[model samples]
Target: MEYLILAIIGLASGIVGALVGLGGGVILVPATLFIGINLGMIDGITPQTVVGLSVVMMIFIGLASTLSYMKSKTIDYRSSLIFFAGSIPGTLLGAYVNKGLDLPSFNLYFGILLIILSTLLLVRKYLKPVEWFVKHGKKRSFTDATGETFVFGYPVWFALVLTFGVGFASGLFGIGGGSIIVPAMILLFLFPPHVAVGTSMFMVLLSAVVNSITHISLGNVPWLYTIPVIPAAYMGAKIGAALNQKMKSETLVFALRIILLLLGVRSIIDGIWG
Candidate 1:
């Protein structure tokens, strides 16, 4: 059954998503696309419809992941508030912008964007941008429930600017922006890897909420299908968070890179060949 297949995909998506910041919806879209096309169930599935359902799924997936990460005390609350400040307005703006876009153009640009992001992640070690971050004299730090302490510093202003774009991308593309944001936090802001994942998950919750509201208003969502996917993703998030606590930092980063790289390649293929 389609529902059974979606549930399985949703579970897998949640595990990888919470661990790396993909937010589960990323996995669902392609899977649904593939299945629907093959089964003739996707004839009514437009970009808007896919984005709407994805945002809805993202809302629950992110909330579930955030709760799990918070259990570990890995989420950065103060910074998360600032992230919400920027992401909220940006998500709304993205929906407005998305309304005028065509599917081919959207796929083409989105694909190109993914490839560029992948390249940035791959060459991050060799690239250094202008150091424009405002510093806290006292380092910002937090200890997770596991007693793992993470300390790091980033400019509040820089984060605000970055989150705005991240939110916009999430709305436009139906991703949680963790794929991009977590890498930016780790490589650019010097965040501890696990902390970055936790913080990104927190941000994902807020952005998905805002984006979901916008998409729902637009009537793009297929609630009937979305309902079955939620519980599996929720359970997967908990499992992923547990795995996150045990994985080595190097291994996490490697996995994230591979995910981003694969997303890039897939997006390009969709744009060029689909």
Candidate 2:
């Protein structure tokens, strides 16, 4: 029964992660904690174990989504490499930092992070790209299937610093870092939305690999539980990538915002009162 629930969670997370380029850890980690620990449905669940499992799932999820995006030609390889340069070390740092967190503290901080991410989703459309980043940084362009062209870029140094922070968040929280990266790409670097999503997934894939290795070394992963999650997430990612190309996601995103907000509040309450 626990395995079944985990599979379902993996499917949902994969779809959402692929749709938004989040690498699915945002949904995967929270759901696992709520169900396995908060609800007492599974044994031996801890924040560290949950993070480890989520990062492991991300390895497959990121691969699936990144491969899908590759066929679309939306990824920026050069920028992704630059982003990776900084993210690797940042991920290592975050993994070390995560070892010190207790359940209540982890819940509190994770809740805060979720709220911030939810708020970003809520207001992202209304925010314009930062002209300074676009104007002063390097320039690059992409031509989409519709023959529409987008010009965008940032300084290599800035990208490195930005992705470093993103990697830290990913390793600390066991997320893909797309919640922050996607927004920065669109709002700071003026990347085309599709390109941002694709590139962010690529970065997520790279960071997750390093994050997983770090967690494994720490002995945090619960290998048995991952059996059901990996395949389900991989399949769901394919579905999500297809959906991303076929339909509008405004309504789904709005729903996701509300879900994130509620989950964040719940986590905060649990942290304080449980």
Candidate 3:
């Protein structure tokens, strides 16, 4: 029954992940907490164990979604590499920090980040760029200039900084890091939303792998549980990607924001009251 519940959750998470370029960790964490509490795994050390296991499972989820994106040629390898360069080191540092932090503190900080990310997603529409400015303070005056400015996207330095922050956050929270990266790439990097989703999956894949290794080294992962969750997640990712092609961009963004907001609120409640 535990395995069955996890499988269902993995499928749902995979669909969300593939469609929005998230690792589904925001959903997974809370779901796992609910399940763990029900199963009486809420005792000392078990909640952390569930979190560690969930992170390990997300590594597989990211890989599966990345493969689907790669097959569709949606991944931007150059941008992914730049993001990975910073995220890899940050993930390692985050893993070490996770080892030292208490569970409540971890949950509280993680919840706060999610809330901030959710709010950002909710307000993205209103924050759309009205003008494009170059590093030299020159603003694009023409519509064509605006389009061209965003065509290839933001400068490489900006991408690097964004990636590093996402990676660090991923490590700190034991998540796939796509929640922050996908939105950041689309909103700040000026990449097409779909392309950002695909590219973010690739970055999540790499970061998850690094984080998984750290988790394993620390004996924090449960391989038995991860095995079933991973494959289901991959299959669900493919299905979600297909659906993404048929959805309106605005609708998808709105749905993602609502989901994030709910998850953020849930995490906060669980951290404080559970």
TM-score of each: 0.89, 0.93, 0.87
Instruction: Report the lDDT tens digits of candidate 3 across residue range 36-100.
Output: 66355433334456557657767777777777777767788877888888788777777777777
Every candidate's lDDT = 0.75, 0.84, 0.71
Model 1 C-alpha lDDT per residue in residues 76-104, reported as the tens digit of each score: 87777787787777788887777886666
Better of 1 and 2 by TM-score: 2
Candidate structures ordered by TM-score, highest first:
2, 1, 3
Every model's Cα RMSD, please?
2.6, 1.9, 4.0
List model 2 lDDT by residue over 176-245, tens digit each.
Answer: 7877787678768988777887888888888888999999999999999999999999998888777777
Off by over 4 Å in 1: 38-43, 128-138, 142-150
Q: Which is the better candidate, 2 or 3, if ranked by lDDT?
A: 2
Model 2, TM vs. native: 0.93
Candidate 1 lDDT at 72 equals 73
What's the count of clashing pairs in each model shown? 1, 0, 0
Which is better, 1 or 3, measured by lDDT?
A: 1
Model 2 lDDT-worst window of ten? 247-256
- Model 1, poorest ten-residue lDDT window? 129-138
